[model samples]
Target chain A: GEEVAQTPKHLVRGEGQKAKLYCAPIKGHSYVFWYQQVLKNEFKFLISFQNENVFDETGMPKERFSAKCLPNSPCSLEIQATKLEDSAVYFCASSQYYSGNTIYFGEGSWLTVV
Target chain B: AQSVAQPEDQVNVAEGNPLTVKCTYSVSGNPYLFWYVQYPNRGLQFLLKYITGDNLVKGSYGFEAEFNKSQTSFHLKKPSALVSDSALYFCAVSLRTGNEKLTFGTGTRLTIIP
Candidate 1:
C-alpha cells in the first residue's frame, strides 16, 4: 500500500473489555510507530518496530498494553481491560529510516471506551 | 531527550492574509524537525520536515517552515490563508541519533476566518 492503513475506524468498547487495533505500514517502509492521541490534543508515543523487531517499548504500558509486528502480518496493538482513560485515537505511522526521514501516518483508529 | 514546544493554543488569520505558527525545540545535538496537520477526526498529515541544508523548507499544501538554529525554532508559514487550511498543527522534534520516537508539541489550532 502507498499509505499506512489502519483498521476499525471507530470502536466502542465497554470498560473492562478488550480493544484491538491493526496497522499495515506502507510498502517498503521498515519502521512502524504507534501513537495515542487523547482529548487534550497531546500525542503520546506508544511503541515502534523496526521490521518485525521491537525497536522501542519505553512508552508502552507493560501491565495491560501489548503490541506485535510479525512476518507477513499487519502490526497490532491490543489493550486488555480497557478503562475510560484508554479512549483515544490510535495512529499508525511508518518511515523508511529512523533518522532524517519523513514519517507517513494512517487515518487512525478511534477507540471509545464507555 | 528531544522536546518540541508550540507556543500558541489558537491562531486566527483572515482568509487572504499570511499566517504563522510558532515552534521551538530542544535537543542534545542537531535535531530533526517536522510539522504535521490534523483535520477534525483525521490523523496527522505530514506537512514538512527540516533535516539539513536549507533553512527554509517547503511542504504539502503550500506550507513552508523556516528553521532557525540560534532561536531553536521551526515555525510554520503560508503565503496565504484558506478556510480549508484551518486545522490542528503540531510541531515535532527528534534527535539525529539514538531515539526513534518523535516528541510532539501540545499542538496549535489554526482557524482561518472567512
Candidate 2:
C-alpha cells in the first residue's frame, strides 16, 4: 500500500476558470487536512475532514473554494472562478488519530492562476 | 487563532556542523508542536512532534526539536549537518486533540554548505 497520494502534481488555470485537486489519504486514516501556501505566505489551514464529515473549514474562502472527503474515495478541493490570489501550493495531510498527531503529507498540487 | 513564526528566512550551516532553525508559536491552548521538512518542489515530510512529556523529541534524519513551554518555542536542530539536509523546513502547532486545525510557519530554507 502506498502513502498519501495526490493527483495532477501541477495545475494551471486561467482566471475565472475552475480547478480541482484530488488526494487519496492513507488507508485507515480518519482525519484529513487541507492547507494552502502562497508565496511568502504562511501555510494556512483551508479545511479538515473526519471521514466524510467536515470537521473544520473556517479558513475556506466563502465564495468559491469547496472540499469533500468521501468514504473510501479520494478527497477533492475545487476552486471555482479561480483568482490570482488562489494560486498556490495546495497540500493534503492525513492522520490516523483525531488529535492531529503523526500526520502524513502528500506530494501536494501546485496551482498556478493566470 | 493559532500561528507559527519562523524567524529566519534562511538558515545557513556548514556541513558537519550543528544547525538550528528557530521557531516560535502562538496558540490559545496547550500546543502540539511539529516539524516538517520539504525538498524543492516537494511536499512536507514530518520530522518530529512534541505532544507531551519530554521537552526534547527526536525524529527522522537526525533532526530533533525542543519544545519549551515558557519560551513558546519549538526549535528544530540537527547534531551534525549533511549537505543532503538542505531543504525548506516548516514548524506547525495544533491543539491537544488531533481534530484541531494545524497552524504552520511561513517556512525556513535551510542550506547546508558542503
Candidate 3:
C-alpha cells in the first residue's frame, strides 16, 4: 500500500486557466507538507498542514495559490490563473512529527502550463 | 529560519567505490537532518535521518550518514557504490520547533559509473 497518494499525476493547462492537485496523506500521520520542484533542481517549500489545520502558509503565494485539508477529505493545492512559470512537479508528504521524523512523499503531480 | 546547503551540483563515483555527498545546514537550536533520493520524474524517497543520540545512522540501501553537530553537517555516505544509485540526492533540515516545515537543499545529482 502506498503511504501517500497524489492524484492527476500529469496535468496540462493553458496560461490563465486554473489548476488543482490533490494529496492523501498516510493514515495516522498528523503532519502534511507540500513542495514545488522547479526546473532548476530546487525544491521550494509551499505549505503544510497539521491535521485539518494549517501549520504554515509562509511560502504560499497569496494571490493565486491556496490549499486546504478538510476532515475526511484529501488535501488539495489549487492554483488560479496558471502561469508558464508555475509548471513543475508538486510533491506532497506526511510525517508523524514536525521536528524530527521521516517524511514520506507521494509520486507528485506534474503540472505543465503553456 | 532553517536552511540546507548541498555545495556540490553533481558527484561521480565508480562502482564498488566509496561515495560521499556533502550537506551543511543552518538553523536555530537543535537540528533534525534527513537525506532523500529521487529518480527522474519521481518523488523523493527517504534515505535516512539524524534526530539525536548517535552521530552515525544507517538507513535504507546500505546508506549511512554522520551527524557532526560542531560542523553543522550531515553528509550521506556509502561504503560501496552501485550503478543503480545514480539519482538526485537531497539534504534537508528542520529546527527543533514542533511546527516548522523542512528546508531542502537544491539537490545533488549522483552518477555512479559501472
**Model 1 segments beyond 4 Å from truth?**
none
| Model 2, span B27-68: residue lDDT tens | 888989999899988888999999888899999999998999
Candidate 1 per-residue lDDT over residues A14-52, each given as its tens digit: 999999999999999999999999887999999999989
Error of 1 at A87 (Å): 0.5
Clashing pairs in 3: none
Superior candidate under TM-score, 1 versus 2: 1
Give the alpha carbon lDDT tens digit for every residue of A1-114 in model 3.
Answer: 358999999999999999999999999898899999998788899999999999999899989999999999999999999999999999999988645777899999999999
lDDT, candidate 3, B27-73, per-residue tens: 88888899999998789999999988999999999999999989999
Give a tens-digit lDDT track for model 1, residues B33-57. 9999999988889899998998999
Candidate 3 is scored at a TM of 0.97
Window of ten residues with lowest summed lDDT in model 1 chain A: A95-104
Better of 2 and 3 by TM-score: 3
The DockQ-derived docking category for candidate 2 is: medium
Ranked by DockQ, top first: 3, 2, 1
Off by over 4 Å in 3: none
| Model 1: fnat (fraction of native contacts) | 0.71
Of 2 and 3, the candidate ranking higher by lDDT? 3
